[model samples]
Target: MPPKKLSISRIRAESRVRSDDPDLNRSSSSNRARKRYRSVAAGSSSSNASRYAKRKRPPQPKLSARVLSILEDDMRETQVQNRFAPDLRAERQNVSYRPLTLTQKARRDGADFQVPTLASMCCSIVANCFDSLLPSRDNFDAAAAAAGGRSASSSTAKKPIKNSHTLKKTTSTRKRSKTRAFGAAPDSDGDQQDYVPSEDDTPATKASSRSTRSRRGAPGTASSISSPNQLLAGWTTSELHYLTRKTSEQLRLLSLAASFLLYKTLVEQAPQYLTNTIISTYFLPPILSSSAASSTASTAAKTHVWLPASIPLLSHDNSAAAFLVGHLTSAITAAREYRFTLSRATEEDIPLTVLPSRLSLAQPVSFALRSLQLHGLTRLQDATLARLFEAAEPGPQQQSILRLDTISLRGCIAIADRTVTAICRSTGSTLRYLNLDHTDITANSVSTIMTSSPDLQTLKLGYNEHLSD
Candidate 1:
């Protein structure tokens, strides 16, 4: 088969027809321009046109003037109604439009549509139930009559006699009796019931009843009628006197019990009955007392008060317990008269020794050092003595050992010059007597004591191997 060949004249006519079409000419020119631009962009270094070419976006459809104006009005109204939004009209000439959030929309529309709270709903349900369960007035009156053996009609007379003058006199007398019953004197011990006025009562009768009610419940009467327990509920003189009679061990146990009870009852009951001051003043003296009882009945077994560390009041970070210990150490030195010592064998004339082991659990040894007026401390380490005196030193928050008359550091093998210096520095002005026998203190501590303590009249320095003449 032979293939048909197109003539040069036919090809020329087709090319002329294609070139004559306006759309084809325009598309060809656009394609040529795009290709030339890309080629030129690739040759440039500074120009990023080839890497990030600008995309030609389609033109957005224009909205009508009415639709645009309506959108603007809605945005303006939302901004104006938003309470949290600042007034941009005062800050700037042009205010930007922001879409209202769901919260804003709800707030704007919630004025007339309030959703009741859970509490209100529950209260309403309870009230409805209570009202339904309550007996009617007639039933309540019948029940009261059955319980008290007195009818309502007998208390509140309903019948009126025909004699007008006699009825008036009887009514006045009845009113006086009712007033005496309902509005008895505040000091009167008899029980009183509320008086409900009936429609038959006159305006004058109602006024008189109100006056009587007011007098019965006057403020002066409230104070006079208050329970005696209310006055003696807190730390009072009676508590102080009771505590003065108790032994040191008893005081410690009382404080522990009180602290525990206070912590337990604070959530459910009032804690005003037992406060920190009460515990410290009354219960703490026995624990803080350094002197043992001089009675013949006092034995060696009753010499020490053991404090357990396992108790939550002593172990935990309780503010009340901390306050009690801190106040004993800083504010109050000795709540009562007592002497301090470490020996338990001598009980009559010698000061009593409160076991340091017991004290370490409830409070620091510093509290004893601060509280002791006549100290006979012994067998204590040098570091322990130094730390105790250091804490007792005067500072911005607390005072040093006040009115310290005497101190004995006998048999303290570890007592050094530093501890003696600290002691003298803290209580030098009040220190009248000091004993440093059988200690490690040298002539240097003696010189320090002589210079620091001006009021010192008696000084004992014996068996000190370090002391040189």
Candidate 2:
């Protein structure tokens, strides 16, 4: 193919014509200026323009690469070790202990003593057995001996007298005449049932009657005596002591059983009874205490009681078990020094149980908690205040509230560490509502509590000058 050469004169003539047109010259100069401005702007400190010109890539950490490689090796070793490690199931089972039962308590209460069990033996157990002011077995036995030479079985002695009356009433006219001469009231039902005196006699009156009857040696006109077991039901100083001893062991067992039963019942039952405070204050304390922690299974039975951990730790059954938890909470509240004594009278006499000795403080806390439900604040002494909080059940998730609102804590009141911990852990989540106002909790304790419970709603740290967190 033939190629044609362009003349230099032709290109020069076209450049001259373009340069002569004013708009074309202006547009060429303007376009050149725009290119220059864009180049300057791209090099400037404005991040968007610079980013568009040069893309940034993150720098890889030099140490991270090596560390990850080492971690991978360690993980492989861990997996291998885990395959040969001792079974967690075995270790956990070995550590597991069964709680003590309340069977012996019911048996002891129902015992029919044949040979005299020395009052000293019974009294020794009675001394620290309970956390209440119940009476001792010695006092009961003494009262029994003083009443008559009879025992708890003595009421049955009159059964033969009743039988004789029955036989006599069924006999001929001679028997009827004999019954009339004895001034026997006509058997109203005609079944010939013997008349029995009521056993609910006042202690002093009953004692006086016994003395008078003993001196006179005259048999009572009534042929039947009510069962003596009914007479033993009331609380005397002696009976109180005995009941205190018996109830301690029994109550502990029953409480554990109730907790176990609570687990099974929670599925089918409405969550009603088990409260966060009850589990912490009543059930968990002894388990965590040095006393229970240090003791062996055998010693645990003697020293403390066992609760079946198999069931859900908390139960919401509104049954008697729930009432039991309530009683326990009340007992813990009543166990304050000031509650027991307005002035110093007794020191060693303070009863020590898993629960409190006095049940009276419950009334005040119950009233206070009710007031809190309506008024959001209830004024109470530290002891009662502590109890009201203890009685309040946890939330739906079993979370308890940390309550210190409007409480006056005197030096006489004592709260345990376990209780404080329970409050801290349970109240951590929505803690902004806390009212530690006027509580004597120190700064150090408050800080410790805050470390556990991070979300605090309202904490009165002013009076607690010692606290700082």
Candidate 3:
């Protein structure tokens, strides 16, 4: 029939076969190949990633029931033991605590073994006297009450109730009195002007008025009678008699302690007390005597009073040395007869120039030194030594009056021929002992010393490298 109506299925099957052929469907085949390649590449990448990835850790095994029960039992036993344990915090805290009975026993034992010295007894008596002399709380209260009562009575007596007319008259009279008191000139009308005080007038008038008010207000005030002497006025005559009855030695000790306390406590407040003749005569003697004693104990006792033992070795750099030298010079001047030894246990270098200058004394330092130990003056110079030797006031004969019985220059490395020569020339007549140890002095200086110092009993030239026979 009609050239053959092609069936739809037959047509579709032929088209599909054609499409499968590579020649007929080149673009589709290329796409299919690309997809296959991409799939392969993705698979390879996944495999590679899996191979290189970090491995997870294996799970830990669970505890067995028996082990768990054992741990629980152990924990329970620890908890029970902790609960039953004694609370020792308080007991431990009291480890160092001593009972009253034990403390008393220890104190009694110490007292029984301890033997008090005369010095200790004297000190205790003096301390007791000082304590007794001091104003007590009750005395202060009584003084305050007396002062208040006096002020109140004086105020009441001075200020009486007055009528308005009388008050006006009083005020006018007061203004006239103030004008007269301030030396203010009256006006041409003969009436005192308003009198406004200047700054200078105000201060003086205020001071005078305050003083007058104080005198009128409270004559028995503590401030009016609180001086040291006034404070001592309250002491019974028997106490004064007891003090006067003390032996001279006891008096001297008391004076020494009193002076020391005064100087130590009130040096800044009242330095004029240091210049008191009574203090100089009584207080300085003991100090000078104590300082003169060559014994170690005596030296140690007086060391802290003037020269503290804690002074640094480099004394030249320390202002404390200057302060000490100044005070020492004054002390020497105060007690001239007593021969003192100026010894530095630490072997510090003292500036010889400071001695002659007398920084603290109005006059030059004058003393006949028994011993002058300049043991560690490494930087001491010849000129300084000469100046020190010539420090004394010249006598009528124009000769040095300085008398040094002993001069120790040990470890003074700066000493040279000039220094030795100067020392021999200045102090040669009186110099009994001279130490030139560890110095730069030569044989020539030694010869000069021998020629000059005929009475030299001791000459120490050891460790002088420049010295030769």
Candidate 4:
């Protein structure tokens, strides 16, 4: 059915007619209002029904005492673990080890535009940091005008002054105050007043008393810098430091001389080690001074004036002989170069008896003295011997001690049989005096030497306990 369309003019004419007829018009309007109400109610009801239908849920398990009890038990277990065994728990969801805080910004005035901004705060922080590194202005403009604008900011910041000038003043004043507060003033009689020390004694008094006690050779203070090297006995740091700066040759000669003095001191100290007739006769000085002071004064002699710095006496490890050989070789070279013969060189110029290479004296090849002048340094192992004969090659002078016709290791120890055998093998015929007195050499060594050197004129094996009777 194609509905008929009413013309606007016809509708308007009908509306006018209706207005003229009041009762008909009222009835028609009432009908229209009722129809509108019905349509609105129907639409609203349909929409609400669809909404409720979407919201409705399936039946759920009601809240029960058992579920509540279980929840409470689980919570208690977690609480117990957190209290006692915290390590057992899992980490938080969004966990971090660092303590993070929210970014904060402050509003200054009623208008946020006039508020202190982040840029201003940052600038202030930067300025503060810059000011910390530099000296603060003493007479800062205190009357910084508080202008109506936010830019007018006058901050007065200070910390306990730690500048050099302030520190010096404070320290000086503190010391003066301490002295005045602690020390007793002189009485009217001009007699020194002794302030009896009590529990309330000040730090200044304690420090003064400690210094006095140190001067008096306090128990723990004395022997604080003693070295294990018995050679550096009574040596001061100032003297050692001074000597270390000298030329190598000077150092070698001076150190050797100093060692010789110290060695003599060690002997005179009445060493518990067994002494021999050879040592007593040749090595020890006629008037052996036992005191350490006498040894120190050995440098006071006019001859040692070349050594401007005080000599430091120090001994080293098992290779003390090896160390001595280096210095001795250099010392000999220096003495030969320089016209002056050191006391050490003079003392060492006895004969080609011991390792005469230890001395600056040039040993004549024609001589043969079997007696050895071992300086009781049993620590002289094969290496020490190697260092002694390092300069002298294996051609002809290799057999004889220090390229001399004689060899003596009297009162020496730790000389192995093989060491002696090697030496015997090297020497063809120039060998004459092979003195192995009171040495650590065995019978096998003596046999090897006899076999090796058939024409050995003198083989003084006296006091050699290693040989069979």
Candidate 5:
């Protein structure tokens, strides 16, 4: 084959002949050359076949059941830890607890969003006003005396249970512990409303004796002796505000003074003791006195204003002493920086004023509102203020008692409708603790609150026998 080489001119002559001759056509040879060129360009040459062969995929690592179970447990624990960890800075300090919500933004900045929901504002205002009151030892002694002495002895012995004042010290300590876990410092504005009481862990006998002595006197008798440190006890919100138009001046002064002291104590023991006390007692003079028509042109000397001798101001906590301390410290500082002028007739004279917009809280030190006098609140006017039931989500860093307690608003003020609605909407099915002791709420309110909330566990309706659906 190597000896059969042909010249270029001979090959060209043969190709020309083949092009015209059908029997000698070169189509097959030309196709073979095209295929050969394609194969070389594609890199599919026979020499590279082994190197380009397909490979099997690597197997995936298999996890054992034990390893999987461990992973799941770790995930669960992490979730729990995240949920339980409280925000230290915001939880115990006066901070807004509500996250920025779509509806709130619309309502807050919207000019047309007015529906007369003043509960939160009122609470803040009242709290500030109360904080202004200075705690006086004289007030506590007088109130204790007026409540007919803490001893079980009663002239109307028919209701033996009513006169009993014995309380378990361990129970009080437990209450204090729980409150300490929940309470935080008030903001600089001094608008905080929640208070937790201190625990007096003395023997039950000792504690009862102290309480009895504090109360054993003519309603309105004043005592100079320092009460046992654990003498202060908590009341329901309604009890704190049980004002009557027929109250004596001495009793009114005592109620105011005791409230002031409670505020002082709370402030001093921030992390340990705080209290949310509601004072609802007062004696209101008649706006239109029938006796005025019979008065001879001579004006009678003003009768000593009557105050409640046995006023049982209700509160929603354990002790208010720690709360009082916070307000005292802040007020002292505020008085130094600003000049406050109050009229004799105004509640401000008793230190109850609107809270300031700005606050200067320092570290663990915080402030609270102090109101020593009940201006318009009275027993007969109780119907008016009673009709003024209001509810609000407590400020940030503060826990809402509504979150943990049930609330009944039967005969309370209709004006509280919006506040109650707001609380219901926020808490929904989680409302478990409630105290509607002797309120005048309708069955409708009770049903609505209960039906809407399925989580209620503790309800104090002892005085609210009227509540029915």
Candidate 6:
């Protein structure tokens, strides 16, 4: 087919029509713009490169060979051997190196011993197999003799060939004589009946007999754990126990390294609490139940211990907060229980404080904060305040409302008469000290509080100028 050609005017008309097409204009314009940009960039780069090349720095002047050699010689002479170089072993007389102390020496010695490991077990097994395969000459000879004798005796006697006709009678007579000497009856021809077993003598029974005999000769019994072969396993177990002890978490960090399996085993066995390592010169003990972290206190006393130990960590370390996530209720429960135990354990009212402030740390109860001193509690949502009340619920044995003997609502801007009513409802029966200073409460609610809190020792209704007192 001949190539079709368009006139110049026809081509101009087509170009104008295509220019009106937004798709074609957009696509072609982008490509043209890209090419123009590349060309401009190339030109600019070439010009910059030439400009920089023309302004190239001249070679720096060098000293004559004789001057250079003289200077280097002088430099070498004054070098002083670089006494304060990067080498760590370099020591100065004025600053003596730190000596290894008794503790460091003990640590070094402890680190010298290594556990029998999993990787070396394969080598031991292979070595044992190789030793078994290479038997000594005496053993080989004995085994060969036993095998040959057993095989020859196990075979059945065939009919005598024509060549052996003369000797067959002699052979049979010799076998008969041997069997008779042993006092067993001989077979009709060659005494094969003497070796044949009865129907009751099964292979299973013979195997059982052999096993029992071997067991009697075995080296170890159930109580015999003192063998050298067991030492490796026992040592490994002890080492793992030592590593998992909370003290090891601090001490072993300096020297000991652990594989994943060992690390996992240690974590699984480690206690949930801290332990004291340096007790009576021993590194760590089997357990530290008496330690601050793992106290054996009753639930209430444990809360007293746990709250004091954990609250600081929670305030300072975000990561430590996870350890106390589910224990908030338990802590409150313990506080409530503490009140009960104190009543039974002694005559005095050991004042206690349930957490009245969100940001305050837990502390030991010299006297429970029977005086609930809270700040800005009124700013908290009603639901949150109610939740706090709910959390303070006592155990089944507890009878009194949590020691709300004294409540000082100081500097609370958001409290109302209804809030005081709620507070009075919780602690109304036992309250002895009531301080409603700098609050929004009115005399109307004050009467209700006084009515509920019959045991109040002192009431400071000051700074509530709106009370019209």
- TM-score for each model: 0.25, 0.20, 0.29, 0.29, 0.20, 0.25
lDDT of each: 0.45, 0.37, 0.48, 0.40, 0.35, 0.43
Candidate closest to the true structure, highest lDDT: 3
Q: Decide which is better by lDDT, 4 or 5.
A: 4
lDDT of 4 by residue, 301-354 (tens): 111101100011111134444444454333223322222233344577734453
> What tens-digit string does per-residue lDDT give for candidate 3 at 285-349?
22344333332112111212322111222222323333333444454433333222232311455
Pick by TM-score: 2 or 3, better one: 3
> Cα RMSDs of all predictions?
36.6, 30.2, 34.0, 42.0, 35.7, 30.4
- Which order, best to worst by lDDT? 3, 1, 6, 4, 2, 5
lDDT at residue 422 of model 3 (Cα atoms): 59
Candidate 2 whole-model C-alpha lDDT, 0 to 1: 0.37
The residue ranges of model 4 lying beyond 4 angstroms of the native Cα positions read: 1-215, 219-316, 319-373, 382-402, 427-433, 451-465
Question: In angstroms, how far off is 411's CA in candidate 3?
Answer: 1.2
Candidate 1, 2-121: lDDT as tens digits: 989999999888876756667766657777899999888777743665445556444433433432343357453233222222222334336675656657767987877466556544
Backbone clashes, candidate 3: 0
**Candidate 4, poorest ten consecutive residues by summed lDDT:** 305-314
Residue-level lDDT tens digits of model 2 in 174-226:
12222333454565444233333343334555667666556455454222222
Provide the clashing-pair count of each candidate structure.
1, 16, 0, 5, 81, 5
Model 2: how far is 109 from its true place, Å? 41
Tell me the TM-score of model 5. 0.20
Return model 6's CA RMSD, one decimal. Answer: 30.4
Ranking by TM-score: 3, 4, 6, 1, 5, 2
Q: Which stretches of candidate 1 lie over 4 Å from their true place?
A: 1-379, 396-401
* Candidate 5 local lDDT, 217-301, one digit each (tens): 6354333343322223332223333422112232244333333433333322221222222221122111112233222112211
